[model samples]
Target chain A: MEIKAIGCEPLSLKRVGIQDGHTLKVYQDTGGYVQLKKAFGMSPDEIIQHVKDSALRGRGGAGFPTGMKWSFVPKDSPKPKYIVCNADESEPGSFKDRYLLEYDPHALIEGMIIAGWALKASTGYIYFRGEYNYLIHIMDRALAEARDAGLLGKNIFGSGFDMDIHTHTGAGAYICGEETALLSSLEGFRGHPRMKPPFPAVEGLYACPTVVNNVETLTSIPQILEMGGIAWRDLGTEKSGGTKLWSISGHVKKPGVYELPMGYADMEKFIMEDCGGMLRDNKLKAVIPGGSSVYIMNAGQILGKNVTLDYEGIVEAGSMLGTGGMMVMDETVDVVETTKNLSEFYKHESCGWCTPCREGTDWLVKIFNRISVGEGRPEDAQLLLDICDNIEGKSFCPLGDAAAWPVQSAIKQFPDDFKKWLTKKANGNGIEANI
Target chain B: MAAATPTSYTDKVIVSDEVAEFSPEIIAEMNEHLAKYPPERKRSALIPILMLIIQRERGWVDNAGVNFLAKFLDLEVTDIWETATFYSMFNLRPVGRHHIQICKTLSCKIMGEPEITEHICSKLGIHPGETTEDGKFTVSLVECLGSCGTAPMMQIGYDFHEDLTIETVDQILDSLR
Candidate 1:
């Protein structure tokens, strides 16, 4: 397998593996709050302009430009503007955000101060997912430490800047990771994605101008401010800037989170070299380059085809760089079964906001379930694609498109796997496949 | 995705007018959560308050608890139930002392989750979503818990057990008992 020459350099995860790393003292000792001190010198617009030049994009699935998103928040709004950190990392095959929150809780706080300065927001909320209840205490303690140190409350660093960060726990909705849905959940309402004409910048989080950013994306701000924006931009490609934390899982010998430079890690080398090769030395069958929401790639397309891990490279390979979640599958695994499990996830997590996503996700799960139990029809494949076509753009939110992409790409890349299920024998829940 | 109103997608929840009572300590704890939000936004403390109710009154959100929260937080009963039922972590019914939520997402499924789930169920003498007759354990098949890197995992309460094998499952359950 051919490999890229770029070496590993820990940026966001710099303090993740350190001892007592979540404490404020340990973090401050390692130059944690320096960026917040530095930001006291520059104007909010200057910080936003520096980030725009840095070219840092959202690490969440959308990949929206971070600086541009902050700029979208109205500067002249009378209402209390807010900054929300989307710590609801619920994408299947992704676990990068939890690592940052678990080990280096103060890094996010320092980054939030800088992000808040750029957005001119007073109060910030970290909308943590419910399953991560353990990290809440860690965050609460860190915030208390910062508060006692006079770094978080009024007149922080004696610069007359007042900001407070709070942690809001999500119940358990994957859709809550979406900005609007997250806003609704934060307001103690049902987790549903609202229509996006006004957008969050115009009216969000109690109808105030809000800037929702991903955990890793916001965590990169402190570093971006430390190193000049031009230097940070140089670390990544022209379009996708800065190093990203990639959550690599499934059928790999060593499946852990790796922080690699954008467009630097080749697909073959990522699995073979960085991951210590595939599990049990099995041959690669397929790879979901991003999270399960993105398209799936067959072995031929990923093995030696110069496929990259950045946004442009993965998009060039007909997929997205969603949350940098790479799920690798070996030849022993059944593609149809994997797709069925993923379909069930979307079906269960569907907010039922739009008819297309609510009904279409259930249909996908049912069809895949039938195929798994040897009760599928030959015509079901075409019907599945037809349903995907309806749900992709018809739904109100991206959840529908998230449900459609995996099923459509699974069949598109591995049609024979779905077709062979028609006559295949099933042992209770799954069919034996040699696809 | 559309602007569907709450009435269009109302979830059926068991409602009761019987208000459950809390201890002084627990009420004080709920007050602490209430202190996090602004006085005008008392509804913002609904979730954490309900969580405390779950911890104090049985192991799940019951009709009595929802009614009490409605009075405590000064919100409509439907509002409390809507937020309670939307999240999977909030148990709408009674739960066993220990709730085992096995992640059934793609990554875990690919990494022998079926076997791990089966072993846990068979040993516990119940199926997924069913609590043990002794009320000691409840085995549930849940969605991803964001521990995909260490697949075939289950979360019991706040603790996560990853890289599950049949042997490990047996040991973990035995230690719990």
Candidate 2:
């Protein structure tokens, strides 16, 4: 939380000032659950309308509109509906959700409660990744505090709106971050993704209409309700509403989590001034603007292009504002090895639900291993790209796309780097290596 | 405390026919998780109960524990292994007491994972997937555990030891026993 002046105050981690921010006493003292009173007073459609006006998007990588996501929960479903919080913070460079879960549990709880009111949901679940197994007690204690205060369970705030939240742990499957796969994991099945069309909104946990939102996205509800959606929308850019929690790491002088209004400054300035520039004052090389899942940009693309750090602006810089997990690499870093590192992650974490993500990730690793050991072919670069092309949209979920993106972009941005992996003998003889 | 985390000791596939037994208190705790789901879908409680029970009663998810859960949840044995084997967190076989899972993903790799891995493995006199002589330590190069800001981190048991260095790792390992 320590840093120099970064221009904007953080809305998400605002409670960080409190010594016991995780406790309910401090959370309630800071105008906490009062939003629930105002929220329940308004009609469900009214709440959704305010959210729509806020222009709030999901903070869990995908920038889908939160208001629209909630509205999709069929109001007339015969089965009981639920609001699910996607607290699976397993993305490679992203650790923003952990900050929220650890420091501001009540904010997320309050957000889920308000969501329950909007969707008429009676139950909620906060699905934490298994790696975060150590932090479950923090969330459990916070939820216990709320229930002790009659803030959760049967007739919350005396409005007869009953809603309760539970904590579910995912063992170690990254695929569960996808909404369908998360729901599957919550249902005590393998964390494999289900098909789209009957998305989580229509049929989710327990085969009921469920709305799965990121921890940050759910935590934004109380603020969006308090400030009124339009004012919140105006807080950031026209396209991206409100502040964002960015997880910036790697080769930066001051590597840590930071929050600022969306598009507050160009990413170059943020990296140079805010993040204290490249580590050891080394020359900047490549940058993964978003989480490791998105496109990788070189120095030419980001150093002086005035690339803003919002959704639209990042897309303008040829990368998605994916989870805002920016990973900066210095000249000492090797692009081929780094991309190969992530491919290993994908291969290790791929749920084996489909062939492309399961086998393609393994094949990518084999090719990278071949290249790393000085056995790479002249065709290996294109073969890598070809494999990436085949896997991009062919899997059950976006895990395959996430696995393929950085490798694909790295090759496109640093073709020479992959080519450098080829042995001198292979390069000289124009050898067509077979793997 | 990190006993229930991401690590696998061996590549050999092994299963135990002996079913695991739990205390009455453990059954009560599992019943609480089962109550969270519906009456018919007892399988929904499998992951949560397995996480809570497997970590404490047993160090790894052996076939015995799987059998107990299958009978307890009214699920088929395939239904049990299918879910258990899918997640990396569930160690299918036994692991050493201190399951040191070093992050080998992009950020951590770029930082200094190789040196840390080499340091720990050599100190333990074992390789990445091997256990120590006395079985006190096991080192495995795991993917990212979402602690990117503090790169070169490892989750020994359930606690995260981040910003790892050779000296700090030595201190941590020395203090572990």
Candidate 3:
């Protein structure tokens, strides 16, 4: 089997080994710290401008411009600044960060350094998910090596600037993936998120000027520095630049990580030709174009739109290209039951810091759980919408909105499934009997 | 009426062998976390340390474990249990060796996860929340395992098995066995 390369360029698997964590040797051999040397030569403002010109967007679902985010950090702020890499790969169907952390950890380290330099932050923290215990070992070792090499600590590469990176493991909380909540956890507080607007750039991690970026977002930076902003922009569409790592799973014949150009067309073609088509001859039932946070579209809707795998294309189809976790489902699936399952997750993960999110998520889970088990009420559909509305924008964090969006969108697209559950309940069918 | 010594409370807590093995690692990691905060507020490490202890023991912070952790951190046992149960990560009950956490979230469910879960239950001969007699697998109808794009997914141990089918699940089970 041939090893795949990043950006479709032939890669030396020896550099980024497929094994658990291979960032150290890869950093050593591939002249990894050379970019740091190049970066140290440039002023922090120049580095920020370079990223802005490159039009590199955040890979952590929101697609916010990376450089713009860095510029938000107040220059004269007295607060000890921080740069946090959101390595919490908890988004349903998203596993790209796991690969980057396991395969190219130095890529993340370099990205953090550039971000730190741009934001004028001296400390960086990576909040990885608890499930990734092995990856933490790899990252810890890499950080130690970098420190020993005089790349991370005081006068890194003999430059006057000093920077340090720390890796902190999360205790299986999906909400902690959010920037504010991540900051809270890093500060030794409860992992529950705080409100935005005094966003992380202005007030984060100990109420200091902070910049929180996703793992993929950080990993893409080193390449931008090496190839120049224009070179990277040329690969993707006008708005989205550089190649993205798509972690395609579910129903596909070959389900694994694939590096494709940003604006790759025809979701079906990408799945069928590039990654191999649906497993066996199962007919497509539905597809969650992005991670679980995005709305699910029926297979008919996806195929009808001639869906392309990109940010704009997905948005046009009423779904965001969230973290590129393309989950495909075959026919013989029940939509009501599926929505119930997702609602349950949100309910469980809710930190209970905010009433709307905590209560709304719990209500959504209860309603969907009843519906899936054939005990749904006729008014349950309206109740789900009401709960979503209550939770969205009302909670202290975006996780509430993230949990609510899928349920609201699913009901809008597939009302009949909910109706069926209600009808089944009225017919004296037991909750589990409908299945 | 005299003030009680901190060590007096330690006698009441039962430290199991597994808990003892995990204490050093927990103390070391907790100390590191404590260093991040002001030295006086070392109690900040309580939750994470409890999580670490539970993880090392593979699910559920038992009463003894919680008691031991409380003594270790000089916190009340009730406080640790409250923190442990607040998060979903701590499994209160004994989970099967291969804990099959099926995502029943809205995005996953809409993507046909319910049928997949039903198939899992039928194959395993156990319903959601029920473990197999042989203890090979415990099929828990969990909230999102966070592979939403790959709806109809489950997490077995640390690895996420997405785009699931009865066939895929069976193969996964077989491989694990």
Report, for every candidate in turn, its global Cα lDDT versus the true structure.
0.85, 0.86, 0.73
In order, the B-chain TM-scores come to 0.88, 0.88, 0.78
Using TM-score as the measure, the top candidate is 2
**How does model 3 score on DockQ?**
0.28
- Best by DockQ, which number? 2
The Cα error of candidate 1 at residue A9, in Å, is: 2.3
- Where does candidate 3 stray beyond 4 Å? A1-23, A304-306, A428-435, B1-44, B53-83, B91-177
Among all windows of 10 consecutive residues in model 1 chain B, the one with the lowest summed lDDT is B3-12
Per-candidate DockQ values are: 0.52, 0.73, 0.28
Clashes of 3: 23
After superposing candidate 2, which stretches have Cα over 4 Å from the reference? A1-5, A423-435, B1-16
True contacts kept of each: 0.81, 0.89, 0.33
- Candidate 3 residue A434 Cα shift, in angstroms, is 20
Question: Which scores better on DockQ, 1 or 3?
Answer: 1
Interface RMSD after interface superposition, each candidate: 2.6, 1.2, 4.1
Ten residues in a row with the worst lDDT in model 2 chain A?
A1-10
> For candidate 2, lDDT tens digit of each residue in A281-300?
99999989789899999999
lDDT tens digits by residue: candidate 1, A286-368: 99978889998889888788877789999998888998788999999888888888899999999998899999999998888
Model 3 error, position B11 (Å): 18
